[model samples]
Target: MRVAFALSLLAALLSGCASHSNPSPDGAWINQTAIDAAAEGGNLRQALLAHGPNLEWNIDTKGGKAIASNGFELSEGKIVSAADGKLRIDFYGNSFEDLTLKGDALVQTATDSGPEQRFKAPKEAAPAGAQPGTSFERGLYSAYLGGKWSIVQGEGQGGVVEFQPDGSVSGLPGNDRYALCLAGDCAAMSGEYDSMWLEKNEQGNPWIFVRSGNQLEIFQAVNNAKADEMPDLRPGASQWVLQKN
Candidate 1:
């Protein structure tokens, strides 16, 4: 179930909007034209939705921003406009695209008379592991590490810990009392000992650990391209990962 949840989350992040906007990006939107162009009519909408080209628009009082992720290319930019109800966004300050709001979605067009492209909204959330009162099954397991937006399988033992339904864990390093918190996509297990939680590394991917029996895997939940760039740690050096019987 946990694995399925993680996969689903990844799917949503990759193919769909699965967004969280203070203003809700007016719900997720997708530029199907761009998606189709990138896929070259290979019936890859579903795959593209999970591993294709897409963008996210987050607008609020602070400012309007856009995020575009397709394959290994990630573009982030501010939404600029001089006319009412119009948006022009420049990604990485290299190129600019225009968008107009229609009803509840953002519509993109190459020219004033061009066909329209659309972006749709998806789900929202916080990190799974650190959510307060959250629980994992009690058992023994191995561990993995997250990098480049994907989980690195068989990295090592994250911990041989037992998750109790009452919101506590045992057998973690130091045998310390730990509590679960759901702040970002990763949860923080705070207590007597150090906690291993998922957060964005040098790259903007959420790296975290998940347990499944004897396999506690660490993964980069968002971007998996540059995962190999993360530094390696020798066993027993970091309490974040541990072994169990």
Candidate 2:
């Protein structure tokens, strides 16, 4: 009897594995291609990453909205399930779509069974990183730092921070001014600041150390890239992800 039960469980697991041919949509998806015949020259030029249960839309990270009505808006979403190469998306106000995974592309079929839209994976998660200890040049980053940097982790994970050339940082409501200190590639905030520098992560992504008295807060830079694309600027939570404009 025990042997029979073990065989049943193994069969169930095998069946589940056989269901989906495409890789799971749990990581970043870049390189898009819209082969929809009815797509009147409407290009699907965006990518998405399913960070566990949360969906990270590229437009939101890049700071923009869809140009057309069919264009995907900058919003957050939850993954109902991803199985058999089919993914169901649910957003606020009952908005959703059923997508299929075909090879390295994500296909979204029209309601009328019209042409389908596809999002392809990029060659790499992000562009290659510069060697560690690369310094931040004030002249190159001055403009990018002047504005606001907000958190992109769905909700309540981060606040906007502004950088001034004089090595001062400010922007969360009611937060006092703080001094910005840089050594090599790492950055820190001290003097009336809520956190201080500790150390960077093993991946060597851009990050900041924040230790307020005894509490610690680490912010990692996401979408880190060279100045040509955009300044490596947005920092979110402990991962310390940053993408600058």
Candidate 3:
């Protein structure tokens, strides 16, 4: 009888361990810490500041699906459990990341030796129409319009232009203040300034435009160009590119 009791205790202990081994991470998680760190000039702060104030990861393990959004882009992925118990998310393309459940948070490392970042479940629901993956176009516009930019291929090649947060520009050729064409009727501006707009290329990447007085200057993000070559900046004969500084 004592032997049977000992065996039963061992089984119960093993069952408890198994139960705690794979906790279900089936919900939405946000990296609020990263948002706070961005305000303090932490790593990737530029992109973070350009995007909205938050980053989110949504996991649906039962459906083997996951979504990650950095306000600008929404990436959908497949979630799978690895042999070593790490949760791996394979994004649509070649990108992927692994996560592990800590106490109440999911931890992920940007690289093998990078610091582990924590994502916790939000305490409150996101505001209406303001959830992750919903502000891609607006975030993309903000990213291109904010901060310092360098003219890479336009008539102002090699010159630097600063787009201040107060809608003022320092080094643009013929315009002082600028307004983003977020919606209908960009030409109906009430102020003396240039108007900026964005359009997607064939590859779905964005290209920017600025109507400075009468001459329209087109721009592509320098980072998106091919190595040692410029993209075909069309709609006009001249090529224009902007590199974020």
Per-candidate total of colliding backbone pairs: 40, 16, 0
lDDT of 1: 0.37
lDDT per residue for candidate 2 within 2-21, as digits (tens), equals 99999999999888776555
Ranking the candidates on lDDT from highest down gives 3, 2, 1
List lDDT for all candidates, in order: 0.37, 0.38, 0.54
Candidate scoring better on lDDT of 1 and 3: 3
* Candidate 1 lDDT tens digits, 1-245: 99999999999886555232212343234443333342332222232334323334333314666655432234667777624457777775767767766555666656543444565432222134432111111110001111111212233233245544332445433333323222222222211111233222222222334434333433333332355654332113222433323
Best-fitting candidate, measured by lDDT? 3
Candidate 1 global Cα RMSD: 17.0
- Which residue pairs in candidate 3 have backbone atoms (N, alpha carbon, C) closer than 3 angstroms, thus clashing? none
lDDT tens digits, residue span 1-245, model 3: 99999999999999988777666677777765644443332223343444333366777788998887754456788985643436898876677788888766777756653445677776554446564643332333234455667887666788887765444566655556554433223322211222353222211333345443223355542333356754323232335665666
- Model 3, CA-based lDDT: 0.54
Q: Give the TM-score of candidate 1.
A: 0.32
